[model samples]
Target: MIVHLIDGTYEIFRQYYAPRPGHLDGDGREIGATRGVVQSVFTMLQDGATHLGVATDHVIESFRNNLWPTYKSSAGMDPLLLGQFGWLEDALRALGVAVWPMVDVEADDGLASAAAVAAADPRVEQVVICTPDKDLGQCVGGKVVQLDRRQDKLIDVDGVIEKFGVPAGSIPDWLALVGDTADGFPGLPGFGAKTAATLLARYGHLEDIPADAADWDVTVRGAAKLAATLVAQRENADLFKVIATVRTDAEVGTVDDWHWSGPTAAFPAWCERFGWPRLAQDAAALAAARS
Candidate 1:
């Protein structure tokens, strides 16, 4: 069986900004994002996805915030979207999808952990992490792959190299050197994507690179200045690497636990409350057809 792992946070963010009309519940709360995500997953089920899990950031702040003060947080986020995080998790659970509502850790870590667990199972044919997030690149290899639903791209180990210019294992190191604006870390001065990829392609990791540019075998523009900056800010680079690395140790359960049986008995009431009458019928029909 193929295991599908979704980044629920990204899906919510994407759907919030989608061109579709906004939806409001009877209480006048904005629920467009949550509805959109649930509908999308329902469609995935219609397309024959039997085993799946969604990882959501129950609280936007995670352990990374302690490491770097400027790491991404709920600050300045649309309160409408923030308010729906809990609703989304509840709706998915009612729909009978395995939902990982992460508390202290972010959704990315949960996805990485689930991907590792799913990939390790001998019965699993493939593990697909459905997200465009670059941080998930480190988890791509072997039976595990990443699917960017927006771009309709499936990324394997070779695809990671083609896109990042280095192997999948070096993505964290490359992100450390080039810096991730989304994650709020400034890499070593004078480092850009190409520069980091080239250096990392040679050295394979941040610590493996020589402190002196003169000791480096690869030719880069302004190698001496870049090397000096890296040496001076080695601690920060290491910290950034730590931040970039997606932890696979989260307790996301085994592959068998993610199997989709069918929507719960409460799902119809959930759809009625959301005014999505058609969703309940479609879900029931799909469940019956599969059975």
Candidate 2:
């Protein structure tokens, strides 16, 4: 069996910027992103998806914010888009998709957790992490791939190596050195793409790197400054690693618990609230088919 793990936060962002207008359900509840999310999930289900799970950031402020003051916070986000987070999770559950709404942990962490759990199961043949987030790359292992549902891109372990120029294990260190804008932390100055990879490939981690540029063995541009910056901001590199590493300890439930069983009676109420008549019928049909 294949497990398809989706990044619900990314989906919300995608639907918010879509050209389509807002959708109003029977009770006049506005559901723009929620409708888009249901459509995307349905499209995937039509494309032979069996075991599917979606992870959403129930609260945007995760543990990463505590580590770095400049890390991503929802304070600047649009209220309309932020309001849809909960509705999206409810809509997915109504459509029979397993939903993981993370509070302290973010959606990426939940996807990483799901990938780890699925990869360990012998019954799960492939675990498709359905997001383009770079952090999820660390969870890509044998038979586990990252799927960007928007672009229909499937990223495997080789794809991780090809994209980052390092193995999956080195992604955290690479991200630490390179920095991530989405997470809101700027990597060390002069530590661009090539320099970080060569150093990480040589030393395995930032901690093992030589403190002085003169002690370096590998050749790269601006080596002296990059090495100097790394030593000067060793504390920042360690902090970035802490932010980059996705936690797998989230309560995503087991594979059997995540098995799709369609929706219960609450599904129709959700559709009615959102004024999505067609969705109610389609969801009911899918639920009956699975039963």
Candidate 3:
């Protein structure tokens, strides 16, 4: 069985900004993104996805914000997008799919946890984390992989190496040196992607790198200055690594818990609310066919 873990927050952001028609509820709240996400899930179900779960950030601010003052938050996000977070969770639940609405932790942590759990089960043939977030590279290996649904790309262990120039295990270390602008942490200066990847690919991790450039085994331009910067910002690098690492202990349930059993009785009402009654019929048909 293939287990699919979705980054619901990413999907919401993607759909919200997409240049498509807008939808509004009776209360004048924009809900087009939420509607698009539900339709996308239905499309996945039609394409034979089983035992899938979606992880959503119930709130944009998480424990990471407490750690780093500059971490991404909902401060400047569109109110339309923010308003649909709860609706997305509810819609997924109504679709009979397992939904993990994280409050303290971010959605990435939930995907990591679900991937870990699914990969550990021998019954699962593969665990596909459906997101393009580079932070998730650390979770790609063995039965666990990543799927960028928008691009229709499947990323395995080799894909991680080819893209990042380092192995999957060293992703957090790589991010620490290269810095993730999207995550709001500035990595050490003079360490671009190529430099960070070259060093990480050679030494394997931040701590493994030699303190002195003279002791380096590989040849890299500006090794002396890079080494000095690392030394000066060792504490920041360590903190960034901690922030980049995805937590695998979020409370997502077992593989069996994510199985699709069919929609709930409230599904029809939700479909009507979304002004897409055909979804209700399609869901019922799919359920009947599966049964």
Tens digits of per-residue lDDT for model 2, 1-291: 998888999988998898979876665656778888878887777666778899999999998899999999899898888988989988888777899999999999898888889989999999988889889898887878888766878888888878887788888999999999988998888788788888887887888889887888989888878877887888999989989999999988888877776666677777666666677787667767866
Model 2: which residue pairs collide?
Answer: 25-274, 25-275, 26-275
Model 2: residues with Cα > 4 Å off, grouped in runs: 26-29
Model 3 scores what on Cα lDDT? Answer: 0.93
User: Model 3, 162-275: lDDT tens per residue?
Assistant: 999999999999999988999898888999999999899999999999999999988899999999999999999999999999999999989999999799998888888888
Query: What's the lDDT for candidate 1?
Result: 0.92
TM per candidate: 0.98, 0.94, 0.99
lDDT for every model? 0.92, 0.85, 0.93
lDDT of 1 by residue, 1-291 (tens): 999999999999999999988898887778889889999999999898999999999999999999998998999998999999999999999899999989899899999999989888999999999999999999999899999999999999999999999999999999998889998888778999999999999999999999999999999999999999999999999999999999988889888889988898888877876789889888888888888
Quote model 2's TM-score: 0.94
Point out the higher-scoring one by TM-score: 2 or 3.
3
Worst window of 10 by summed lDDT in candidate 3 = 21-30
Best by lDDT: 3
